[model samples]
Target chain A: MTDATPSALSPLAIDVRGARYVYPTGNVTALGGVDLQVKPGEIIGIIGQNGSGKTTLTKLLNGLLKPTAGTVIVDGVDTAKKSVQEMAPHVGYVFQNPNHQLFARTVQMELEFGPRNIGLSEEEIAVRVAEAVEFFGLQDYIEEHPYRVSFPIRKLVGIASIVAMRPPILILDEPSTGQDHNTTHVINGLMRRLRDQGTTVVCVSHDMPLLADVVERVIVMKSTEIIADASPREVFADKTLMARTNLQAPQVTEIALQTVVPLGGPVALTPAELAADIAMRTGRPAAARTDAVG
Target chain B: MSMQAALPVAMIPGNSIIHRINPIAKLVWVVGYVVLAFSTQNIVVLYSMALFALLLAPIAGITKPLLKGALILVPVGSSLLALQIIAPAVERPWTPVGEIGPLTLYGDGIYYGFVLLGRIVASLLLALVMVMTTHPSDLFTSLSKLKVPYTLNFMLAMTLQLIPVFQREVGIIMSAQKSRGMKGKGFSAVLPSFVPVFVGAIERVQQLSISLESRGFGSNGIKTSYRQVRGRPSDWVIGIVGALALGGLSAYSIWRGTWNISSDIVFSPLFVVVTFVISATLFFGVVLFAVFLSLKK
Candidate 1:
């Protein structure tokens, strides 16, 4: 839902009102008048082509980049009035490049860095570090240097490092970039788990299938503005919107739209849904159908 | 691509004696080499030192980078040598090998050129051995152990890590510029592309600062390190011995009134022999320790 119409009962986790960002150096407008809102625990995916202001938008939420116009209220605190360091406890950001965020010598230290920075007690820091290490499957390399790890593992360490901070809202920029299928699957599972635990997850990604599978809402951006914000199913169903944004629906969704639509069957966002739609149209027994698709 | 391939002299993982030697020990060795290079100008002594440093490369598992650095330095060293030999800064009583315009090449200048080449080769090899064996973190940890300021240590580590990143960005910027029909060659041509590259670097730095702050970099609490640098008894022994040897050489040079004896003092053959023996022993001792540790392990 747009930030302008959030109900009073459930306060918005992220509220942006006519938020606009311009690069100071070139006077280039990156975000041209954006308005959006994210409810607490909502898993939202932001998708756009290069230079569509997806990253710049995420930076605004964390106070890394201030909005040139309007306001960004994260967890009821106006981001413009707070320094990035002050907003860190509320909005944890995981940068795309693990190298840029990773400065500690070891994985354990990296995970503890954020928690310790927020002035958590030693006991609390230990609990967070243990949880992150276990969740990210980093037990084996806890003592090893972060840079010595593989690229996929490094990205996981970067995510886990932010996760350990226990910020109510987590923002991941390009989490699936350069990841293999299994790694992306693992990341998707992690994001879902975080959402289930009542942490709001805002992920910016180029992977349509991943966004469709994990995020409940998908926001399509084009030319520095949000063009569509709807449930993944509704967003993927809009052919004109997808074309204008230079995005493609997930393969399964595309197939369902192409083949299943002719048969008057419902659209599927995932392969499993497509399979089930096909089975139902063919009159297969529900018990005989596989439960593999999401 | 592997990270090692991207770096100039990537640390090769191994249990070799050289790797086991404390980073502080390696640092001390580097300091000693610098001191020795500056203390004496005898061609025989300097050449022996360079030869000895090069000889340690294989034992440390860094011969590849060592050879690469040496090959690159050859042309540089030759040019310096040629300059010195062709135009001696000051005339000497030695015989002139050749004359060009108003300048005469002297035998002393040739000897001095060899000494200069030895300094270059020895310094390069010594620094190469240290970096090729030790992790950047370990090096910084050693610096911290020496009581270097934390901020300085952090800056050093970041600088080392950013080298390859900056190189990659430069390549990306050049390609982007070329695709836009921008044409140039060398420094003048590439100068315009630096603006975008610099802008990218500034952005990266801002991101890095935020990342650091989120992790409590400037917090008021005592920060603990997960990777502790352990200085063993062997490290202390090497560090102390290397320090003493370097100190003794400095003292002896000062005592003999030959601390800066480049052209004026008569070349003392005895002092040259003594310097060779001491420096060789010290250098060989480090190599032997690496061998001993590797075999023991």
Candidate 2:
């Protein structure tokens, strides 16, 4: 994982201070008050239950929503002062549902929509769309109507459409929701690739295994406030925090916490990590250890 | 207001007399109000009809929402009034009232404009009272009791139910488009957002049809409503009396030639002043509300 700390010279990718967002209808307080900072090139996961302000926080970052009370700065720009369209070039947000965004007659056109909207040159738009198409393995359905494609392909189209814009910051709201194993693998690989390219990635999801496997840091939200912000291992290891948030660690981590830790094993977040440690203790190869665990 | 609350009319739960009354009875009153409103051209009687609707607001426990909704109608009513005044249909009794820059204001046109506005307000208010107090299920069951085709009743209820759902979908669609660098403002920007909304709607309708079939909807069988509404004697009394009273008044006014007084009272100073006040309030109220909406955004 990329370092979560920002160097002194680089401005933070996302800086939020005492941010509060109250939905106007019924005065529902979606985000009460919180402070958060995200370093450039960092991969962070926000995990919380419904109405816990995870989505609200991401919305604030892209200027889809302005803080009712505090300030949000995205890449040195104040979100409150900029319209959502102005932030679009800097931050690409992929909503949870693909059906809400997949409108173009073809997947190729869908990828082109964002770059074109931000006034990119035709050649640059073509290059970006082609890159995204190849990276997401969407070439097979590139010329197919977006709505006519399978739902998982449509989800990729939704994400590739934004990724083609080449925003410095990318926010994925529940990228793994309703996704199968293969689709989840694609999303995991995409997040890593984006991080490797020095893009800041913030994902809000309820997929515990995805968060543990992919993110460097995890922010736990409860009752519209951040209850914990730490490394995934640190956050998930806290039994009180897990119980309070009504969240569980990945199954491997839960097993390690219950069985391996009592035997002086290190905290393992992923199955591979646990298998490696088990192999070391057994003085055996990791492949054989993985087989035994399986 | 949030998109979810932008429904044209919605039921507000309450235990008030209006809420407890049979929806069919309330529907009768609605029909009565419409007949009375359209039968009259007397500005005084029309304004009085509007006042009667306003008085029903408190009884229905919807005074606040009704007033808030009325604010939205201001601009619409003013535009209609202005259009009629600019070009009156009555050419014979076109007494010139005054002149503004280039166009002569006709007394008949101004009188007709206010008459139309009053009629709209009265009808709108009565409809609001019925819709706001009666739940959609109750309305459907009541109509079913009247032998309204089950299909028709279901369609009405479904339309009401889908208003909020479609509104929320549109909101999501707009946000999704905006996040992908779509312009946040202008009609051109908004036009493209409708495509996904339409696609989503088609998908939803298809799924709904499948679910309905699976649930045995519209099957040939004896169907029962979860909310059975049996009309009480009081409901019958209210429905008949209310419909008869307004219908009788409308007939009497038509017979006595009191419904049309465009030429006789068109020149009254008090009538002119009242018309001006109502129109000005609507115009300024609409402007202020528009400003408020922009500020909220």
Candidate 3:
């Protein structure tokens, strides 16, 4: 996947050709020449240590940031030639900090703000807001000020606001941040639903368990460059790369690598896969219940 | 440029004579500079005052950033010059010197414009030096030592520190709004951004208040600083001398009417030489910045 390049007419959701970004203030190089391509409806997880340019790369797709040196083609359009607002119809960005975006009088209004801003009809805005409310369990806080809600709920409002707009490419920056197990599951389910609906999902996260379950491909970055771009099983199987990048695979995958992989069993990305692999290696029947129950 | 860098006033860390000087001494110098700057319209003296601050930049190890920071003043200074050139504030008998697209240039207005620009440059550079060299905590401590209420001093210092933090926050908020399909232009679009900024600020202030209270910020106790700064004998000497010199110069300028430079003086060879020196210094500073950037790349 690291060497994979998109053909000019391949209908890519995102195409980056040698993108480089240097912060103007400190002249700090956040991204040192990156090239990437994402297909439509694919769920891509970007994993990296802090300051490794995962967020910077995603910002380029939505036109929030223009590459300092190379071209970024999103949905067959040059991002450099379009303003962020103009690109918003094609790409929806959920920021890391929810406080930066939540300012409406109510959560319902907050969810409707984006769709309305993009010129959706009032009826369509209400319908989208209702759908987001149900999807994210935001119905309870529909009439409350977004800031007046719990932090987790506020984060949901922030994400739902962007999701309401229903852009083709959705970028989530640390979606599971500050979320509990139940809310994390809700986000995981949402990503899967969006992917099934053919919305290209690009997620930047440190939540390995969620990524292992939700993402089809994981791109490992270190020091502003992609080190590995592969399937979740392939990426999690490499212990040396994970250690060098200061990252760890999902706990279940790690356990499988340590206990089952040496026994010639395949890598597991979830508790069920790990259990089945362990059962196969030991020639014992797997547990009847492996639903990852609390 | 990043929004924070666009704001020209900030602290730059360095170990130099200017950085080591007591904040009280530097504060006194600022006070004196402000008083002297406003007291005169003499372009030479004003430009010299600006030059003094620029000359100290290398010594302070802030030559690069300071020069880059001064780029903010170029547009302002040019606008002032252009505005005065087109609309002279001189009394009755206007001496029209040239024409700029049907706008008559008045000799008195041109001279006055330079004088005003000189004043602005001097004040701005001095403020930049004060900010770029002396850390906010040091200034807070100095104020505390001067019997200023500790609460007031703390607020002032915190305000200085938070300026950059809020600048970064505003940038993030603008980007977030833009990503949400908000119009990227017009004043109406900007007005919507303020709501989020204010809400974020309020939440931060709440957290800060809680953190402060947890650390006994409200207790009526004598606070001690971890970073001790004491006024040296040399500091007192420089402060006293600088203040007295500014006072003497202010009186001399007023009594001798030295600020009333006639048209003959503006055309003098020496005045041209002085103007050329000022322009050359600024030009070199900009050129040096460009070279430094290219070398860094």
Best by DockQ: 2
For model 3 chain B, where is the 10-residue window of minimal lDDT?
Answer: B268-277
For lDDT, candidate 1 versus 3, the one ahead is: 3
| lDDT (10s digit) by residue, model 2, range A92-133 | 999999998887778898899999998989999999999999
| Candidate 2 colliding pairs | none
lDDT of 3 by residue, B201-264 (tens): 8878999999999999969878878779988999999889888988788777888675666545
| Native contacts recovered by model 3 | 0.80
Clashing residue pairs for model 1: A272-A293
Ranking by lDDT: 2, 3, 1
Give the per-prediction TM-score of chain B. 0.78, 0.87, 0.83
Query: Going through the candidates in order, what fraction of the true interface contacts does each contain?
Result: 0.00, 0.75, 0.80
Local distance difference test values of all predictions, in order: 0.75, 0.83, 0.82
TM-score for each model: 0.50, 0.91, 0.84
RMSD of 1: 20.9
Whole-structure CA lDDT of model 1: 0.75
For model 1, residues A1-294, the per-residue Cα lDDT tens digits are: 111222342378999999999876447899999999998889999999988989889888887678999999987778898766567777888867665555456889778767776677999889989999998899999999877898899899989988887878889888999998778888999999988888899999999999989999998899999999999999998999889888999998999899997788766887777777877878884444343423
Interface RMSD computed for candidate 1 is what? 16.7
Tens digits of per-residue lDDT for model 3 on A111-173?
A: 887988889899988888888888788878999998899888888889889988888788999
Which stretches of model 3 miss by more than 4 angstroms?
Answer: A1-10, A120-127, A264-266, A275-294, B1-6, B61-64, B71-115, B230-233, B251-297
